[model samples]
Target: MTDNRQSLADLASLTNQPAPAAPAAQSLPTSEGDIAAPVSNEPVREPMPLREQILDKQGRAYATGRRKDAVARVWVKPGTGKITINGRDQEVYFARPTLRLVINQVFGITEREGQYDVVCTVKGGGLSGQAGAVKHGISQALTRFEPVLRASVKAAGFLTRDSRVVERKKYGKAKARRSFQFSKR
Candidate 1:
């Protein structure tokens, strides 16, 4: 039997080509024991393109937000901080302190309290859900008004919509998961 395999050097010689060069050795450390940082061969990445500010002819930023069964339409403009919901002041619309806090959380995180005016209309859900919807709307409007704040607001997890909703009831169940009472004879 004849050997068919050929070494890389033998193939190179037959092809009239020089052998491939070996990888370079790592640099030695200096007498001070300080080793140079390794250089990366990776290409440098370019920074992401910035988002553009969106505004209406009236100079207001508009956005819509939804949570659970509630939906809110919001408009943001530069002014002393004032929030109106459903044609009423925030205090009147959301009497509970916690609800008010939920509505203002975005502003608090951006450290932009008392710097803008917000007008929103929310419907279709209970108080808690409505408050959440309003908060989501405000965050979206703020980002639209000042695109630079997008990174911070997104980092705080306000940009993503809340997708949780009530599960549908099954045909044989009393509620989504509760079973009907059994009868004993």
Candidate 2:
């Protein structure tokens, strides 16, 4: 009986091709006790291009934000930090200090407070959701106005939209996950 299997060297010789070179061994520590890390053969990646500024004819940056069931359309421009929402000032619209703080969080993180004016219209959802939507809108508008702030704002996590929402009610449950009252007859 003839052996059908061939060794790798035999196959390479039959194909008239050179054997593949073995990977380079990792360098050991030097006399100075500096351990050399294994060098990767992969090519270095290029940095991503920076975002460009987006503006309208009126020199305003516009963005839309959504939180829960609320949606807010915001326009940002260079001016004193006056925020108008639904034809009312922020102080009037968002009476609670916490709500106002939530709306201004993006500015605080980017350290751009009082540099841009914001005009927004929010609809649907509750006051809290509306405040969050406005904050998101402001963050987006600010990024569109100044592309350079994108990295810092993104690092602070204001660029991401909040996806948490109210859960749906199940047919047999009183609430999303709460069961109806159990009773003994």
Candidate 3:
């Protein structure tokens, strides 16, 4: 065994390879230590922020939502199912049941309907766009309040903004995608 070990070392020496060095001891700072551990040469990276860090003291989460020309500023808080849009009750503001449903779709998907109170002020765009914007806002605010629900909400695609917009009319066209009457009489 001694001869075998010596032969291995001798082979390494013939190859001009230095013997392996022992690992250096490093100490991590403990709870009792006020002194920080030595910094490494690598750049220190800041920790990514989580959804929980974006909340107000009153447990309200706020988000801005946009759809086409519509923009909505929304606030979400825990309360009996109450939704106000532009100081009017949701039903009153969104006369169409479909529009009202659009605004509440996020809560329904999370199965958290009637749990949060949502209030929003919307401007620009038509009623349909406004409803879509409110849905986007509610989804965002819900995520901020509880990060865990992000998966469900995101899976429903509520987190993604709809990019569809009206196409611009060409100079020679009567309307977008509609060319002027072709008369070769």
Candidate 4:
């Protein structure tokens, strides 16, 4: 520490040096100051929550969906509507129009029908379970592709997984809930 009064006086008397000029590559940014500020003090409204944006290099959204014992790995891409399952067309794989309808309900709710191409592989369940799993997967993938659709998809209830599984058979029961016929003999 300098105890000298001369050093203290020099520091106090020193003038600021000229600032270096910005490079040609850099320029001072312009600001729009308070252009939208509320004039009245009644209340300053909070900004709305923004939806998360998701981007994929290949322009695809991938998701895994499950229902009962079924699981489906799904991929969605922007294109004319086409749904493929395990290398077969949905029509061929699902057979029934009702099953196809179940898988397409998300698109119906979001009004994005015929907008995306879907390719998925499902395993470990029957046809109905597989269809439900695909529907769940489609809803999840739609949200991932466009987060802004979350509200619509969630409202339509496709984002929620069906957790109901087959009930375990009791040792004394013929089936999951069935009891052996009682005989008074």
Candidate 1 lDDT by residue in tens digits, 1-185: 01222354667799999755332323555556787678899998997777889999999999998999999999999999999999999999999999999999999999999999999999898999999999899999999999888889999988889999999999999999999998896
TM-scores, each model vs. reference: 0.78, 0.77, 0.72, 0.73
**lDDT value for candidate 3?**
0.87
Better of 1 and 3 by TM-score: 1
User: For residues 1-185, could you state the per-residue lDDT of candidate 3 as single tens digits?
Assistant: 46666776787799998744322312433456555567679997986555554788887999999898899999999999999999999989999999988988898899998999998999999999999999999999899888888988999999999989888988888998898889999
lDDT preference between candidates 2 and 4, better one: 2
TM-score of 3: 0.72
Query: Can you tell me which runs of candidate 4 are displaced by over 4 Å?
Result: 1-48
- Score residue 124 of candidate 3 by CA lDDT: 98
Least lDDT summed over 10 consecutive residues: which range in candidate 1? 1-10
In order, the Cα lDDT scores of the candidates are 0.90, 0.89, 0.87, 0.86
Query: Clash number for every model?
Result: 0, 0, 0, 0
| Candidate 3: 10-residue stretch with minimal lDDT | 20-29
The reply for model 3, stretches above 4 Å from the true place, is 1-50
> What is residue 145's positional error in candidate 1, in angstroms?
0.6
Which lDDT value does model 3 have at 1?
49
